[model samples]
Target: MAEKLLEVRDLVTAFDTEQGRLRAVDGVTFEVEEGKTLGIVGESGCGKSVTALSIMQLLPRPMGHIDGGSILFKARDLVVASADVMHDVRGDEIGMIFQEPMTALNPVQRIGRQVSEVFLLHKEMDKTEAWASSIDVLEKVGIPSPEIRMSEYPHQLSGGMRQRVMIGMALACKPDLLIADEPTTALDVTVQAQILKLIADLQKEMGMSVILITHDLGVIAETCDEVVVMYAGRVVERAPVLELFGNPLHAYTRGLLQSIPRLDRERKTRLPTIEGNVPSLEEMPEGCRFSTRAPEAHDEAAIRERPPFEEAAPGHWVEACRFCYAG
Candidate 1:
């Protein structure tokens, strides 16, 4: 087996809401092997992005915090790493492609300066050298007219171009792991395809592990080696990408798979849905968080206690609900 690059075990992240401390990411766990991609898939608000933010230790502080658990990266745990240690880790050892580049990029800064800052901060390059290297990275990411684009401000560029710039910044330091949070969000279909391909190509070229957090199963199918299905802040099922697509085990996984639109004449019906919404962080139910929405959740144990994840098949895991579910 390839060495583990990132392992998140029993991660618990919470938000200090007015009502109380609400767990946004509840005991989510997954791992990324070196030079591989792990996809985190779920509906919006299912803790997909929260899980990524927790790994990066980029949670909105005071309001948001990692409450417990370990985030091991390259044999070192990040949950306990000092601020200075994490400062070195963020861009040098781990890079992140945040969603919505328009908001994430600085409107006031010229594109070149923003991208070059990574080199100046992490690589100890001088301003002149950093500018030259940033332009090279911009070109590497397929930005047309890198020199001209470097002078442009965020507001002056197209959305796709801005996104490519974001990619340039994220990869400038050649971080060992990249966390992409909804990298294809809000783009045209053509642009989305391009972005996904670009990310895949780069990961392969750099031999970097990746954590792709998205609700799009299609994206996950195309990009990830392993798949993690999350519901209400927990990993309900996890397996190799092919195993997940071929035989999803958890009820939520089945519902998500069923909801994907298809062209078959036999699929001419309203898409399947899980019926109930994911519970709010402030008001989660007792027992299995998914029992509120799972069709197979009928036994008292599903409501009285949470299901443990156990191997249902080789290299495939599912919440051990079948043992307790009455129906």
Candidate 2:
């Protein structure tokens, strides 16, 4: 068994707005083992990205804060880490690949300078060495003609090449844990496959753990070892990839799996979907957050109180009314 690289316990993160303090991640708990990939799968507004940002302590300051709970990275509490400590940890220990490379990359800066900053700031490398290392990493991430590309700006590169540059920058310092927030989003199918494959190859080569946040079950299936299903800022199910796919116990999980467009299956008049919508944080439903959309949420227990995360089989966990999805 691999060592646990990161452990988040009952994490509650919230954003304070004029309306109220809205909890974006409520009581979410999970762990990532060293050299393994843990996928956080959920739809938009499900707090998947927020959870990653909280771990990095990059929440937008006073507006966003960790209300309660602990984020233990390698057994060190990150929630309370000072600014200097967090500054050191961000790129050197826990690198992040943000969703959009165009926005994430500096438009005015040259690609080589941006990539070299990681080595210059954390690795104690001088200008010449850092610049050399930048080109080397670009090549390592499969960028064509790395030396020539180094002098170009973000707009000069195609979407895929820019993404590769982002990956290169993230991995430049060789962090222990990599958090990729929708890394393959907005890319073409072929490019998506290439980016996913690159990440998998890099993780294996570096022997680092990964926290992959995405809504695409297909991507999760291809790269993840374990998956955490989130709905309304809460974890609804957690299990190994195969078990979750083969024997999905939560109604929400089943809905997600069913909604996948399968080429082998007969086309339906209308695609299956979970009716209604994810509740807003302020007006979240009582009992189970998903009970509003659950087909079998008629029982009193499901409506009266929140359900506990119970282990259904080995590592498979389901948190819903006992009778929900029971049939």
Candidate 3:
């Protein structure tokens, strides 16, 4: 069996709003194997990003917090880890690429300084050494004229180049794990493919595990080894990439798969869409969350109470609600 690099067990992350404490990541659980990629797929407001931020312990302070469960990274529980330990772990052991490079990058700082800061802080490198290391990382990410690019500001670089710089910074210390949350967002299709390929190639070269958070099933199919399908703050299905695509068990999963436009389908046929909106957190169902949005006809009573998440097959798990679990 492959070694597990990160194990998140029953993670419940909540945000304090005026209405009440709302759980954004309710009972989220999964594991990332060493040197393997895990994709967390869900629609907006399904708590995918919250789960990732919870693992990183980057939730907004005084508002968002991990209420329950453990984040075991390399066999150490991060839920109770001290600030200093987490600081050391952030860049040295786990690096993250934010969703948008434009917002993530420091606009005021030169590219070289921003990238080199990782080495300066984590590797204890001097100015000279950090600068050189940053150049090498930028070059490794396929950024041409790295030395010149390093001197330019964030605004001077193109979107693809900025993203490449972000990748360079995230991988600067060669961390054992990477968390890329929508790394290719807002980019053109061509640029998206390039960025995805770049990330895959880097993962192979660095032998690092990755947690990819995205709503794009196509990206998940192309890159992920294992997949977790989340809906309304809970995981509805999880399986090997091929297994999930070939045999989805949850109604929500099936609906999502059906909505994907396929070339095999008639060109003018209308694409299927899941009816109804995801319920607001304040109004979330006490039982199976996706029950409100499930397109399939089901016994309403079956979803009146929460169902147990059970292993339906080897390495395959689903929220086995009678209304949702097709199997």
**TM-score winner:** 3
Candidate 1 at residue 260, lDDT? Answer: 83
User: Against the true structure, what is each candidate's TM-score?
Assistant: 0.96, 0.96, 0.98
Cα lDDT tens digits for candidate 1, 221-266: 8888999998888888899999999987777888899888877747
Model 3, span 200-298: residue lDDT tens: 999999999999988899999999999999999999999999999999999899999998989888979788888888899999887888877776555
TM-score of 1: 0.96
Tell me the deviation in Å of residue 198 in model 1.
Answer: 0.8
C-alpha RMSD for every candidate: 1.6, 1.4, 1.1
Tell me the whole-model lDDT of each prediction, alpha carbons only. Answer: 0.86, 0.90, 0.92
lDDT of 3 at 14: 97
- Please name the candidate that would achieve the greatest lDDT relative to the true structure: 3
Off by over 4 Å in 1: 323-327
| Candidate 2, 1-327: lDDT as tens digits | 778999999999999998899999999999999999999998899999899999999898789989999999877899999999999999999999997788889999999889999899998889999999998999999999999999999999999999999999999999999999999887999999999999999999999889999989999998999999999998999999999999999889999998889888878656798788998888886578887777764566676687888888988888856655573
